[model samples]
Target chain A: MTTLPPPSPRKLGLVIDLDTCVGCHACAVACKEWNDGGQFGPLPDRDAYGAEPDGVWFNRVHSYAVEPGSDHAEGASNRCAGPDPESPAPKPGLTVHFPRSCLHCEAPGCVTVCPTGASYKRAEDGIVLVDEDKCIGCQLCAWACPYGAREISVRKGTMQKCTLCVDRIYNETLDEEDRQPACVKACPTRARHFGDLGDAESAVSRLVAERDGYALMPEFGYRPVNRYLPPRPRRDAANAPPAPPREETLDREKLPGVLRWLDRVLSR
Target chain B: MRPTFSILCFTVLSGIGYGAWFLQGLAWAIGPICEAHSAASGVPWELCPVAFWTKAGSMLALLFVSTGLLCSLGHLGKPSRAWRALSQWRSSWLSREGVFALLTFVPFVLIAAQEVALWIAVVRAGPDGTVALSGWVSQGGLPRRLLGFCLAAGSLATVFCTANIYASLKPIRAWNDRHVVPAYLSIGLYGGCLLLAAMTVDRSMEFRDHRILLTGTIVLAVACAWLKHRYWRSIDAQSSTTTGHAIGLESLGTVRPLEAPHTEENYLTHEMGFVLARKHSTKLRRIALAAAFLIPALLAVLTFVLPRVYPLTVWLALASGIVGLFVERWLFFAEAKHAVMAFYGR
Candidate 1:
């Protein structure tokens, strides 16, 4: 009547600090690199070098300039400014970089809609997953998900999603410090953190309490496990002196060959 | 709620079939007790041939139901891989539907076999002779009664399965409600009553039994109409899940998207972006009323007023009612709003 070893408790989740993120897509690239090589390999890119470049990425950072309660002549108040070049209005106090991924919702509609039982949330850790062997490529689960988490793998004819770098994070051979998700590790500004929110003493738990983190589309009642800290107010840039004109800028022609090459690459 | 045409056809057709069976059963249960005059009055009770006709109706009903089931299987992306659907009976409603549908077949087959065997035995025994068989290995009375129970159980189970399929969808606000089950059952009853009216109405202009069926059909039809109207009104009053304040975009207050995700329609757009215009929906509702309720009601009233115009009116009303029900079922799926609409920024 005895059973084998019980499933491991690995509550993989993401903690995004909106204050530090600069809207750069480093975490997205890191996620693609790690996921493409590890368990859910090769997130197929359609027309990578073509005119319409589209592919699946586990993480996507959306940039928005939020103006907090602006008293403008046009009667625009609390409006997110359009990212247009022609706009001559004063800049917003805060620019937000929102990175979205699977929240790993406790009440996952994706799993329940799967006729073949391919999509399921792990009872052990609450990580939502799709069983490739059982999937029938119905795409019903994708339709069921409000977050747009599931992406169809055309080649495999099955749904794929963020696994939070499960294979790498759980690897015993890797060092404890190096076992975090690829996105969390690659966050240059240290905006992304990975930990179990279930544990009250966890880093993510502590941060959530301190920052008053919010979940995306809370009215949907998905009860997303991931937490997003709101962006802090911008510093007073009006008092600071403006930079020198472009014509009076320091000459780059006198720089070393290596330095010039580095400049060119960075500029590109 | 992705409206597979197969399922729509199945529900509509099976609704008629089950409705016909239910009406016929009701007639059978009540006809003997009440000395109600059948339209075919000249035809004797022994030679009335009601049993044979009822059996035929049952066969036709089961055929349509099975055809619907087959069509539904086609909606599955991998039909051969559908076996795995039965594995998650513990939590999944789809699994429950599959299991119940298969289980319903046992009784359906039993009813068919028993009825067919009884017919064959009757034919073999001749008019007057008592056909006798061995004690333990013989002609059974229990089989016929068991067949009745099976047909009743199967009919109910099939309807339950249909209701559960829609009711299980959590994202669709229209489907995930207490009203869905009752609405489905009512539609099924309406479809059955129309079928029964068509079958019982005398071809040579007989008035008996036509009024009762017509009245029953009208009541069901009107109830469906009322329910549908209420459902739509409720949905209209409901607010969007996403608000301007929630998205941090209060300047363009309560914004609806001018464009969709892609230039060319993707899977999500194709599946969920089906928008029936208000004018078209209004027109369809009128048509549904004419076919499902008005025609049947008029025919029922006409049967009492002009007894000579019985069969033609009843048959025409039934034919129109069925077509109307198909349209109604289509609207039921089309009108439903999924919670995912919030993500689309609708």
Candidate 2:
């Protein structure tokens, strides 16, 4: 049962837009709250109010400062310092908030490494899942995953991870609009979109094509279903022409004699 | 990558157990070739009237194996459900290891059971009386040879499965390497030779007289030391994946974590974020090589020069080898950097 299922033609996954994301952790919180009370209930926190509050979460938001001149850089960091007249200038890196979770790959190492056959990928939808009953909690699946998606539940002595909200996505009780992953539904900016990525005609698929979305660490060869739309090029770097020479350039003649001398010395 | 005590004990103890079994199997299969005079006892090894040494050696090997298997259960979160692990041998290396570990017991128990009967017959015949060889449990017989082959093949295969469990994991570059399997085998055999040498000090045995065992132990010790040294060098030279790759944004400018997902340690950080200082790891590596391989090997060589103190030196070698292996195992886990750490901007 640890063997991967045949490729699923209908890959149900997410496509996240980095340009639109605001680094808010609402998706992460919603995922935790829904899962804690849903089918995978009791995502326990060991010390909720104590010094070391440890708990399991299906999603986590990481904020990174992407510097300019890198292969993917659009321009200098968004927070780079303005022209400074005094001290040495500092390059403030651009912030890119990344929400990390399971990618639900077509060939996931996590599913195959499980000794207990607890981890498996669905042939119908390509969604990877764990059967808690069969899991001996050796944590080998966690080690096999490059994405750090699996979390060991110390209290239950079992592995926990993003299920893509299986229970809600197909629930008849929920309204049609609400029938989606908790994280996707909770995104305030609509940064996360969910659909059958396997179908090119699907809105999510077209969105991916238009945005030039990409899979994470494709070199790992998991063939992840989920895609990420890289942040769009910044306005200044995208279409703006070179700025006209500043007409009001500083004039040394109008400066005091001491100031003009200081400027000359500094420039030298 | 955290070096849990249970896992270290399982790997090290089982490696020694299997190593001893391999050597014992060879001796059993060779039949007449192992007929060297035990320096401690005046009788020849193969023609010895009493089967006490053979019986004790087999049982000791079994004991080490059983202890190691038991320790491995501690690594599972749900130990009660550990039986489920053996069901996936078709796909999982860990599962194959479990199945083989259990299957190995068959040959060991069978050999031990027959040896017990042989020992009883020799005891009842009295020290001066000669016990008939008969067809059963006869030295160099077909059945004995077959069992010996089974034991040797089974032991090596189980160790191979164990090594593959680590080597097959692609995310942990340190474990997923060409050197891991060879290093494991060499270390296991080295530990095994030390165990055999120490077994000679048993009260029933009189001398440290097995030349092959002593020489094999020294050779394996040197081999293991060199293999581990190479392993350390390779891992040290390896470059890890960057934060850019982890976030699937390598083409973007350099990625630096501005904020961690959590304020306190999470499971991923606690499990995979283990980082040993360069200075500390280097020191530990030296300690492991010196104490585990170099010193033990030197001690084994010294036993050959001072046959007067063979027992003392062999025992000392085994003791030092065990201590050094523990340190090495600790380093093996502690120094490994998991690929997931890239997301943490580590």
**What is candidate 2's lDDT per residue for B288-342, written digit by digit as tens?**
9899989988887887777777688888998999999999989988888899999
Distance from true position, residue B262, model 1, in Å? 7.1
Cα lDDT for residue A84, candidate 2 = 41
Model 2 regions lying over 4 Å from their true place: A70-90, A237-239, A242-268, B35-52, B127-129, B202-209, B277-279
Relative to the unseen true structure, what is the C-alpha lDDT of residue A227 in candidate 1, on a scale of 0 to 100?
Answer: 80
- For model 1, state the Cα shift of residue A252 in Å: 45
C-alpha root-mean-square deviation, candidate 2: 9.2
Q: Fnat for model 1?
A: 0.15
lDDT of 1: 0.66
Report residue B273 deviation for candidate 1 (angstroms): 3.3
